[model samples]
Target: MSSLGRHHDPIVAIATAPGRGAVGIVRASGKQLQPLVDALIGAPLKPRQAHYGPFRDATGQPIDHGLALFFPAPNSYTGEAVLELQAHGGPVVLQLLLARCLEAGAGIGLRLAEPGEFTERAFLNDKLDLAQAEAVADLIDASTEAAARSASRSLGGAFSAEVEQLAERIVNLRMLVEATLDFPEEEIDFLEKADARGKLAAIRAAVDAVTARARQGALLREGLRVVLAGQPNVGKSSLLNALAGAELAIVTPIAGTTRDRVSETIQIEGVPLHITDTAGLRDDAEAGDEVERIGMARSWESIHSADAIVFLHDLTRLADADYQAADARIAQRLATADPARLLQVFNKADTGVSAGSDGRLLISARTGAGLEALRQALLKRAGWQAAPEGVFIARSRHVQALKQTAEHLAGAAAHASQADQALDLFAEELRLAHLALQSITGRFSADDLLGEIFSRFCIGK
Candidate 1:
């Protein structure tokens, strides 16, 4: 699509992870793979058959012994003739074997693969679409089991198929609407038609449903950013260490143990949560004051920006006399008339914040207590309770496209209600919406997007 560079000759690369192990695989795919195999292994290897063979040098001496499998074109990963060398995993051995391939293939025309070029070839050859191609990278980069599972589903075309199905639904309705516009007398009073309205309602519901799922998928892909914020000595650092299950943050009884944001990526029930522990917020003029001021300013910013804010307070240290001052400071910072993004987190339950702190989590971070409840609360705020069945991996780009398509669909619905002649524009918007949907699945995308998507893939994938 973008006139991306591709080798007309066969391409070869080490497919397995680069390292010394029991076995390593060198994969080759393209037209002219047979000759490379013929020279490298010194025989006419059978297609789809794993032949135990001896690899040799140009002088026809044995280099190493391994199995070679050939997958003929129109059947392999790139719809090309493929050869795989299952050889020793020593880095030096693989390099020698690769060098032999380069030498042998030079006579038969072969080249080394660029980063992500193999997967790019697969996509170009119709083996996978853009989204599935992206899922290839996602699967490789999946940090957690849940992320891996979601990426597996994506690579299996779950996410793309859903988007395609939604587009088909919208297109079907648009066709009906366009038909009504084309021949007003042919269809039974389309606007007043009960079935038409019902169909419209169904499409709307479907769109809303998919949009919600996409949002959740987006959260799963881009984990929730939860910021810990409160006054100095509020046990924010302790809370970070507790959540991270490690000393990710420097915890000290000192008021400003954390002078800057300490971030950690954690997994809770397969949901990735990014926790940012910020410096304490308060008023003071010393260096501690400057640090607290910076921390306080950052706390307010994060509170406004983060998906959820955990407002920490040292229950044992928060004196009744200081509650008014503290709450006033926090309230003033949070005074903006916006949606609620803050959650009260009273720390230092080990110090006994009084039995009256019953409604809130009561635990000692020092003792590694109350963390389960905290994780659950975070997950609840993240809307991550849904099972992975309906969940699929989605990129921010996919979310943005879906949102744009939703906006257009809403506009189309509005037009449908107001003007008889508006069906034409509605049809146009519906087309746009459909294309936007296809963009997610890569049915509709430019070459640049494909290049960008594949560029992230590791070589040999």
Candidate 2:
């Protein structure tokens, strides 16, 4: 259906989770919900007041006894009339209540709400901007306490306000430049007199500050993907268990015990680390089984795609000639595969093995030695910095948009340097920069982009 058609129709959904709880919510939003409310409760409801009553079905039989709430238009979520039925939490009871809403509101064109359609409606109605709408989902899907707090801040408009402020500054600068562009004779001198250059520099500095905070937020939202790669029986599984603080993978002394990838997510200092322990990488043609070959292929794929690769080494075998040869081959492959994301970690340090040179860290997963250092090193490799309070949750798209804004600002600065001959160019650059910033707050977002963003949200939100 067309978006306009969907928006005009009354939408209903079970707002609470699918299982039994103390209470469940069946919510509906529309232009006017008095008819539906009257049909369900068999009485009129006061706006913003909770009316304890029995919800009835089409047959005039009680479906459930619940609390009913009526939110009038322009004051409710989605800026429309909203009706909420707080029913008993049994799955059957909620389903019955939901069915009754659909049946009762059918005459008014009520239908099941599409995923995120409610929040999408809220965005369309100016109840929340694009970033804040996305934060609703981020807050729901947050995996850590810090991530939840960041998402909450974004939902509270912290991120949108910053973007809007930057956009406003850009707009003001564009007006100044455009005014100067209108008079070619006094363009250069007028721009200098207005301190346009100083304002541009100040705006750029603010953009840089917001960009830095957005990077930290993106780190919190997406976290880091780290893969552990080494020869078989090198304590890779042991390290995984130690980092996760759980026996997530099987650790055997036999080579190739882990013939597949074992994955776990562990948080360090409120930042989640998605760690994957891959099968041991070996070049033994005689020992290659069919399953082991596939496992090794997958391991290489993980290494190439990971945010960081932990190249684990058994310190006890560092002196062995054969082991040294294998380690050299692995190092050569790593050197070719983005050395910046690779961290050399020597394990089994408790076995009386001295540390190696070349920025390698020596630790023992068995003894929990140097694990904290390894955690810190992983965070560093991911380019994650500790964010200050009130940092909002951000996505990669937000980062890219800010980057585009920064580029446009840089272009504007270049044009401003030659204001006498390039006033038009400078004004155009500032306009483009303002539009890019608007994309973050939904002032200039594409319809398809809006669809993609809101489609990820759960139904009833």
Candidate 3:
């Protein structure tokens, strides 16, 4: 399926990190790197060979001396000719070398690489599939070892291979059903056979397996967004520091100390946790109007937008008027909030609060009390498994697609129950659903989607 004239022209860019380092790399790919090679190193280069050379300007003066590597067509990153020049990482040196390549290849039309343009080219050239291309970004953005491993599985096509297998099974069953289309007489017996239902059941089971693992992968990759909210100085900051095991938040006896949202990512038993501590709710007459207003706004946001809320309560001060008022306010927030992803926690149990209700937990962040219960609560919320051996990362788009596909399948089943068994029509519906599942794995790709995805990746990925 390779296009014959799909050379994207030569693109040159700095692959290494910006700013000074030991050395910086300048890379070029396309049909013609000869001009750049000849001008930069003063000679045409052999494929995959590293040659010592001096990069020159248009007038043939030395710009910088360094090692040059050349990869010829159909074997490079973009499936075309590639050239690399490594020079000192100084900003001045890289600029000089890049200017040289542009001038040398100007006649052949060289363009600057956009952010992730190189990887997008790789995807277009069939060097990587859609899922693998996305995995490139996931791998870069992975925070924990588990996320990295899941992303690696995605890149290796473990996820896509599962989808393809399921798609093939669905197609085969459709083929069996379609086999009776030519001979109307044998259709009833063929459709009534026990084997037909069994095959459909097996396909359903496979879909279920793939979906469950994809869900696990998604939870791992995206992590849980846990927001802490309570009256001022109820140990919200202390809990963040305890869970994070570091002073990520400034803790003091002074209430409303944390004026801004402080966030930290910590792993609790292989599950990545995104914890946010916001300004606590309180009634302060002398408080800055903007600060109170902003804090109240953020409290509402965290309550509704968070994946889960750890509603901290100071056990010692629960009877206090201001603290009681804060609790009532939370009840009001919940009534008006998103009505999903909420949890309640009573902190400072070491000060003598016995135990929490069935759905709540009491903890002392200072003494590490109730931390295990807290961690387990989060793990349960995230649907985290101990071992994500076969997990494959999924986006919200993937989740929504799978859901739609399931809906289509449900409709097909209902149609069949109503005795409308023009299974060719049913099969086509299944096919659409199957295609949606395939989109998760890159089986049916759109050019624009690929563009958007790889454009978010860092260059040289």
Candidate 4:
């Protein structure tokens, strides 16, 4: 069906999650829901008020006793009339209720809602902007309390507000620049009088600030991928166990005990870290078997892809010549890695092994010593700045948009600073920057991008 036609039709879905619960919601939204309401309840329901009643089938058979709610057009979630049935959360019950809704509204072309269709409609109807619409999904999928709070902030229009404010500033600057573009003789004098350079500088600074916050928010939403990498038996598994507070990885004294990656997600101060303890690093020829060799290869793969690498070291074994040689080899391979993301952590500090001044963290996975410091370090590596104020959740795309805006603003600044003062170029840059900021709140977004984004949402959102 055409997008227009599909969206115009009445849509129904079991609004609650699948499985039994104390209550479940079956919802319908459309331009006109009076016919469906009459077919289901036989009487008009007070808007926004829940009415306790028995939901009957076409044959007048009571399918379930529940609460019914009606929200008339322009005052509902999708800016359309909405109907909600609060019913028992049993799978069969919801399915039957859903079927009944379709049956009753068949005349109105009511159909099952597609994934994220409800929220998408809300976006289309101006009830929510693009960023706020995305927050609906992010809130549902948040892995940590901080992430949830951030998503809630975004849903409450915090992120969109920032973007809109930034866009408004850019628009005002664009208008000023474009206004001066037609008058070549007066352009320089007009811009100088208006302090265009100063305004552009301030806008650039604002973009930078918002971009930094958006980066931190993206970290909370997406989390970090951290890989524990070093020679075999470097206490990687033990450290993983300590960080996770669970024995998620098998820890054995024997070398090559772990032949694959064992991962666990643990939060430190509301930021999730997806920590993966990989099979110990070793020379391909030194691997004990084909499985171990494949495991080592996979470890390298994880190491290369990880956002951060915990170069775990066994303080007890650092003095051993064989271990040193192996550690040196691993370090050589890791030399190409970004130094900022690579952390050298010496383990087994409880063994009384003195860690010399290398400025590396010293910890004992066995005793949980210095684990807190390690967590802070990981957060630092991820560039997480825990603001005292609430942060709105953002995606990588939002970060990219902010960066694009900054780049265009930089171009505008360059044009403005030139001795010749290219007013047209300056205006064009401002226009582009404005559009970039608009894309964040979906004021200017491609149809395909919208589809890809909403497709990730759970059905009925």
Estimate the Cα RMSD of every predicted model relative to the unseen true structure: 3.2, 1.5, 3.2, 1.6
lDDT of 2: 0.89
Worst 10 residues of 1 by lDDT: 1-10
Lowest summed lDDT window (length 10), candidate 2:
1-10
TM-scores for candidates 1 onward, in order: 0.88, 0.97, 0.90, 0.97
lDDT of 3 by residue, 6-122 (tens): 336677888888889998999888877777776778776777888887888888788788889988767877677778898889988998888777877889989777767776677
Candidates ranked, most accurate by TM-score first: 2, 4, 3, 1
TM-score of 2: 0.97
lDDT of each: 0.78, 0.89, 0.76, 0.89
Better of 1 and 3 by TM-score: 3
- The sequence of per-residue lDDT tens digits that candidate 4 reaches over residues 177-295 is 77777666763685678889999999999999999999989998999999999988889999999999998999899999999999999998888899999999988888899999999
Worst 10 residues of 3 by lDDT: 1-10
- Residue 125 deviation, candidate 1, in Å? 1.8
Q: Candidate 2 deviates by what RMSD? A: 1.5
Clashes of 1: 0
